[model samples]
Target: MKTPEPNACLDRLYRETGLTLRQFAQDVNRLGTERGTPLKYREPSVYQWLQGHMPREAVRPLILEALARRLHRPVTSSEAGFPSSPDQLKQPASTVQGLIHLGREDMDPSRRAVLGTGLFSVALTIPGWPDVVGRMKAIKTDPQRRIGQSEVQAVSAMTDRLSDLDGEFGGRYARPMAAAFLVNTVAPYLKASASSETRKSMMSAASFLCYLTGWMAVDEGAHGRAQEYYVKGLELAGASGDRRAYCHILRGMSVQAANLGHGTPAVRLANAAAEVSPESSPRMRAFLAGQQAHSYALAGEPTNAWNSLREAERAVNQAEGQLGTFGGFSSATLAYCTAEVRHALGDAKGSVKSLKEHFPLRDSTDTQRSKLLFSSLLAERQLEIGHLEAACATWNTVLDDYPALHSGRVDEKVAKIRTLLSPYRANSIARQTAERSRELLVK
Candidate 1:
């Protein structure tokens, strides 16, 4: 039998990473765990891969991602001595075309489970402003169709209505509808010819809807899918020269990373968002700074976190009575961000106080999903401080609204409530809350 030559490409990339064989294997194993498929590889496995032994197909992405993280750039399969995956082999040719493919897959009930299986990768490459800004190549337009500002306005109006539904119900029930809309209505519009002004307007509106859809995906606990949508949104935003939407999408990505407890990437993304748009309105500044504070706290940079928090507070104060900013940065939002920072920095009681401050500031504009999610967080912190009865009361409030919302995040919190109260099963309020949580979980 002929001996296969060593994988020179893999060896080259591995050498560039400068990691010990054991470290490389460990990194891959860690990434596998992050992907919910734990691995037990060691130095021998790494050596074998460098020696032309192919890793399992499913494991290749983990290896690529690990290398990408170490090398600080994208490491494609071909660069790592692996054949292109099916997805890559059939990759979409353009930004709009890719959006169509993603939306179509998301809209398909049969593909839903498969899409849910995509793993969130910390090493995923995000395009910078310079890389994507105003660089969308002209796409082939449908000669038979033409659109105008009315079509763009229609898309914007529909996005607003969808956002309301997502807030009132939950992403699980709303995301599919969004996907259907994107594929059925929006994608075709992108292919329809229009004046340059009208085209840019439509792209801007589509970018916002994409961000909303991605936000909904986050609520549904589909982080990988959310990232995909967010990237597309960023592309569209840049293509249309909409700096505000581009910054907004990047900030949204930061929020998603921070919520998933990925501190470093979260901080990187938040900084990118803030850095790209220095002349943004005070409210926009507050929104970006608040997220930066949370990311810094999660990354354990207490000084930076507090500084960012103060900046956010100052920005919010400066924006008082300013009405034109659309990102909705307010005192309530600042308080919530403060609570998150405090919690991340190990001040549980302070977090509880901040959360309390947040609740009263919230008005009719806040989503029901957020209201319940924050209430559940407050309950968890209350329980953490041994205030069992107080925790129970707060949890009851969440339960009152839980059944009506189909959010994966809210459901996760309710499940945790049951577990947190299990030790206090003898207490009546605790038992009742736990029981109700179990009932809801069953339903």
Candidate 2:
């Protein structure tokens, strides 16, 4: 069966308040800013909501908050046409509705938060083995237009393009594009005619795009929404029999957890992905192992971390294939993970060594974020090794990359650098750069 559309109640509330659609959007953005997300909503987004669209679960509460403040009364979920249970992507046959709702909210600048608000909790990432591995052989679908290989290929190509954009500039740049494509282009196709094989292929493709959306949500710092995307993507992936995508999505969640400093969840997700991973792709295996290593390091299990790193190295050496999507544990990714592991184990100099020796330096495209990250870490590591001048010099790259990116992840690196340099503020170079970072951040 096709997915259902979200119902609407926002129009009535707006009419009662006598605010223009534009004014209503402005109010939402204003309220969001005061609460720290600094949303960028405008008239069209609000118009869509008025026309029966549901905002994302995260945005709905804030939206109601905005409306209540404006109307001088309490605005509840029912009045806004939102579901009482806002644990998104969990309800049955709710995938399409959830996607549409999330799409509208993501596209609206007024609902934009700094991203990654919900900490990556184990509750969100770890699932029972039965739930994840439960696979359906064939979907019973018979849409009207007759879904074909061509449609599946189109979605795949679009997903690849979005992934490329993600690598180049990060999720902030790729998110709206993914959301719009899924909503306008893919949604109709999903709801329309197709045979079992076509449906399976299309479902897998849809699942992949959803995974991409979740990754971008994490990159842009919307952890709760990211988890929602992962859950729905996993459901679709299972039905499509796309074990690879399923494993990859789980690994993606692990990456989020690792970055959020929730080591146990990160390790749990990685281990789950490893258990379900197909043996055909050595590169994928390597990726999962590397992920495990990073998580173990985060968890302060140095022995496990070392063992996992060895396993990762072995798998990377054996890997021989055309690289898969999700970056395929590329050389650069391996180096990054290796550095991360070392850093987690408190080996500042070793992290620096691995970073410089193994870090991908050729064909510099779509890796500015990682490159800048390594440089920034190098600065910190240099400080750890008592090379203050070298540390200061290494920071130049980070400062250079700062203005070119719009990632919340990168903004976080900036914040850390500020704290790291505080004790040395008496030094001329340190004070100067600190001042410079302060000014740039203010802008």
Candidate 3:
């Protein structure tokens, strides 16, 4: 490694982080990639930066975010001897920038380790959600070029195509393609000139893509990055005045929080979705109410949970008059959430009934990965209720589907099953099932 003089500021900052130079460099590269600019810095590179050499311009913001996270405080560019303005750089400055950043970073394989490692944060992620606000800013389009309805259609078309890919193949294969679409294609249109109507369509489509990217992030086991994308998607949807997209984004974020066990924030985000979309169709309300019930169950508030679930059923019924008005709600989604909430509330029988309701509907759909997920959910619930053989059957279902998927989300679920089976090593079926799961998981 090339040597540089021992420097004052860099040494002090490095010491404050308490990470060795190699570790610091790894973090810097990971954070840099997370900010849309992948870096290949090493210990020697850090020494050079500390010895008064300037780092690349894009890397400065990443250094700030990484340092702030490491030291648990805001980091200024000036403190790092970078030329950029010395303001908050930990968070992305704009929704567009953040979305673009997430797209670029998610495309890198090296940074995926960070994604796997820091998928949950109870304290930092949940409480940081902003209060109710609408349409905070307007998107400025580039006047140098003209964009038309064709461009907007293309974005939505690509989003639809990618959505199908995610359903069949899993997000591991689709996330980078989606990110590439956003970074290399959709991003330009977001900044290009378009008619007022076309602009809203573009923004809404972009928001939808960003939200899908967030979902993909979750599938790839990057829940922290997923949260950021959801926030940006919400803002973009809000900016476009797309109530449907905004509500959907909020619901997605709520699911992430609840999955991470941040129950209160999950509840707040779900309510925000409902509150912000007053004109929501009955179908939409059904979906949102179900989401709220999920969070309430996670929060251990059975009254609120059941109340929301009942409201969801009523909304679903009300929407029944309008054919195809289920919007985002389906018989499958309602039952899935019901099973989830019941399991969380420790209603084993209720969970089994709801899971039964869900399986038939979900099986009719083409997504095998979703089957792996809900099957594991049912397996865990069955095990909890002392149905060891039933749990083993569910485990077999998951293992059977496991080979077809390359999804981190499914991997995480099966991993939990492995842990769940550990205590039952004495049972021959449980031991054999766990052993088979381990072998398949390793492959």
Candidate 4:
């Protein structure tokens, strides 16, 4: 049976509102808050609507209530584009494509688009999606041997491969593969009848895979998907009794919330992470503090950002004092966070400085791709500040080295640059760079 399309439901809701996109979102936000369920209506949320995506689960009900207020009538879940329960969601015959389609429908629109666009590039880098039937067979009949040293080594090798793919190809290209491996390989082993030590190792491996998947999803701009993965990772980490991995997942969730502009939630999540395990290593504490600082920066709380950043730095210092290494917190990760926080605070120059520091530490092969992405971000900031020539030059560098990363984000970034440079089309360099990017985009 064909499942209902979310767009059809959304179209009906919009008709009931009788308002344009902006008006509808405003009304929804206002009514939603008045009804005691606040909804965030940011630009990215608006972008989701334009792409024909509906919010999932409780969000749908909140939106419907807002619409009902606007229309002066009652609305139901059926009218708002959602299945009433898991049973309905399960009723449809599930082909792989069907599953993907339904998953897309349930996902936030921006996330769906990000995943759809990135799937091709990411799938090519990892093993193909598992055959569900084959996976079931393996789960049912696989050997019950305890996880040995070899299994730990294998898991480590896989994690390294995932990390490399994330750096070289972008997160969109790595997440699904990680997800597949988790569902097909790791989950089964975790559930197997094995020694406690083996089960712990399996859970740890699965937690790491889940964390990687979450990170990749975040990179692809799928905040909701990233959140789900992180939550699952947190649960697995708990089962493994791995405090360090739990801290990592918490940090990841905070980052996702911050990226989505939910700074308060991000701060709360980060604080909770830090509080839960007081005796976590200095490096782990620093990582958590860095994430909290990022959340504060997004919240426009500069004092908090500065304080947390200082705390993170102090923690790093103490770790260095104890053992010449900063626990497991790598310099690259620290530099990336510094750049991110600066960018969020609208300090393009500071962001650029952090990026410069980070660039030297990135792998040689990743240099071009990383620079292209950073330059694109810097170019946007420059354009915001009315530096047209600098913006144009930055975008030119991005387009010139675009293929290095195979990133959908690069395409989106280039598009933004083109839009910014449109007014300066008569200028030779701007026109040439814009046209070249347009041509590459077309191909």
Candidate 5:
């Protein structure tokens, strides 16, 4: 029998799952590893899948397994468009069209869909997406009348609430809640009346809302949607003449590009951020440098990564000198950059150390959710390096204290741990942890 085209398979998968290519790849990888198949769900493989090339036999099973795990039910190849035999593969075009027809019936309107449910709940937990507070600080506030003050304050308060919800209820709750604020409250205000001062504030708030929305899309592994939101954020920031906001948007773009394996563009964008952020705070400069270092590391340019890391350190050291002008750098912020650099450099111990050093300094409020996330990321890195006990201990601590911190960035960490621990599932402790996490999901 003739082989099904890769694009046909890909189109079918999207139709069946409502997942973007990247999201599907991540899901495939996570589930594959967990099920002991270990398929490589790289970008090229996904592109090939979209073009109708059947994934390796191993990949086909992994895809089915992942869907079963995600949907909490048994799934068959026939349900996925591949039949049991070669002769079955010779099915008519209507067979394929019928699947597409059914997929459409299950499709949710993008705008009306809840932000953090299902796949997005898992997506929200990946490291490095900027948060609402960081985006807000990037925008310049008006010196005169505080026209956008109420809205800014509202967003700030809402961001805090969402962060708390993320820590307590998980990403699934936090995402939709945050998205609701953006679409229902913030986006409407962006289209409202304003004076020059109010306009700046409005732009700042809108840019932040857009950034948050983009972050949510990123968590769900929606790269295209994330890119669109980041571009819109950049435009909003530019309208306010906030170069810092522009820098933040560029950073978001860099992250998305790096994740998509477009490391060259990622590095270029990071460099542009570093070069143009003249008045950035020391912590902010360090943040940019660290991102550049990460991009370079991913590009396999070790020398460049090292140089950028050094630049990041220098920025941090000089932070004291510029304290009066730029405000003292937060230890948590500094640690976040340091941890990211170490993780990218393959220094798992260093990553854990940096995160531990910074974890204590994080705010007790939701603003410190990023720090908690870094700690979880460090744990995952440690697990990667074969430090299972240490990793387990770290996750246990996080789970004990912030059980609700299950979504946004924490879910990624959990998924990684789940994969790592899968090998030891027969071990009682590992089994307990896995079951605990699964149980938490239901809550």
Candidate 6:
């Protein structure tokens, strides 16, 4: 029998990670679980992979992601001694090409299950302002076509309409439509000849749309897919020199990290967003700082968390007379941030109080989906703080709208209602709440 040569490239990368064979195996297994596919690799599996045996194709990305997380940067298949998969071989060469590819994949129902396999890496390389400004690759322009401010306005308007739909309903249905628009309408516009000013405007408009699409993905719990869209948005925002848009997208990425309970990355991303744009308005400052407060709390930095929260409060107070900001950051939003901060810091009672304060401050323009999600959170906290009847009352309100919504996150919360109330089944209200949740789950 012939002896296979050891994988020198994989060996080198593995050494750089400073992980023992068993540690490396455990990392990959942990990441696989995060991606919803639990893995059980052991030291023997790592030894085989290092000894010139190819890892399973499905396990390659998890290995790369583990390495990336350890090294604090992206790790490619080639760099890790893995042969390029068919998808990697055909990777899009430019930002626009990549966006089109992503949109097409998202629009295809058959590809979605595959798309959901993407792993959200804590060390994913986020492009900085200097790294991406004017960085769009040379696109093959369509000689017969041209775009102007009107095209830019159309894209922006469509994004706003899509946002409204996502807010009222859920991303489950709105996302496919957004994907179609990106592939059909926006991709062509990106390739059409246009004046420099018009081109930047279009890119900026498209960037915001990308952010919205990623936000919708987050709503559906397709987190890894959401990170891909957010990175594309950041690239486009930087290419167009739209600092506001870039900062906004970075903040959105931070929100995603925080939502997934990855505190370190969340804090890093939030700080980057706040620091990168030095010319932000007070409202924008508040928007950024509120997220910073949440991220800091999650990371267990009590002093930093409290400081960031105070900064957000002051900034929002200063922003009172300003016209609506990018995310409509207001007193209500500040209150919600306060609730998140308190909760993360283990002050359950305070968290519930801040959450209660958030409701009355909300205006008519707020999204129904948010109202329900936050209400669910409030109920959970109310239960935690021994307000069983109050929790039941809040949950009943969520049930009224739960049947109509199709959010994965909302579904997760609704399902938990049963588990949380199970021990309290002797109480009439708790039993009724559990029954209501069971009925919904059965459907």
Q: Per-residue CA lDDT of candidate 6, range 1-443, in tens?
A: 78878989899999998999999999999988878899999999999989989999999989988887778677899988899998877755688888888888889757777766467878888888999899764768898999999999999989989988888889886888999999999988988999989888998999999999999888888888888889899988988999888998999999999988877889999999988874767788888889999999998998999998998899888886633324748888999999999999999999999999999999867789999999999999999999999999999999998888877789889999999998898999999998998998789
Clashes in each model (backbone N, CA, C under 3 Å)? Answer: 0, 12, 0, 1, 16, 0
Q: Estimate each model's TM-score.
A: 0.89, 0.75, 0.75, 0.67, 0.60, 0.89
Model 3 earns a TM-score of 0.75
Report how far off residue 22 is in candidate 5 (Å): 18
What is the C-alpha lDDT profile of model 1 across 264-382, one tens digit per residue? 88999999999887466788889899999999999999999999999999989989663332365889999999999999999999999999999999877788999999999999999
Instruction: List runs of model 2 lying over 4 Å from the truth.
Output: 1-93, 114-116, 125-144, 360-366
Q: Worst 10-residue stretch by lDDT in candidate 2?
A: 134-143
List, residue by residue over 1-443, the lDDT tens digit for candidate 5: 77655555436545676666677789788765544345567667777766767666656756665555455345566666554545346763321132222223223335424321222111121112233222332333324433457776777667656645654455445555665566555655554555567666666656655666566556555444565556566656766666676777777777766655555667877886776674766677777877788789877788988888787778787665332211234556667656766666677788778877877766544243454566677667767778777777777776664564445456666555666788988877777777776666557
Comparing 4 and 5 on lDDT, the stronger one: 4
Q: In terms of TM-score, how similar is model 1 to the real structure?
A: 0.89
| Candidate 2 lDDT by residue in tens digits, 301-385 | 9999989888878777887755656657656667778888998988888888877765553344436776676677778888888
What would the per-residue lDDT of candidate 3 be over residues 52-153, giving only the tens digit for each residue? 776777566566666766775555666766665544435546667767877888777666654442323333332222331334346576788778888888
Backbone clashes, candidate 4: 1
Worst 10 residues of 3 by lDDT: 123-132
Give the clashing residue pairs of candidate 3, or none. Answer: none
Quote the lDDT for 421 in model 4. 80
| Candidate 3 ranges beyond 4 A from true positions | 1-92, 114-140, 321-327, 363-366
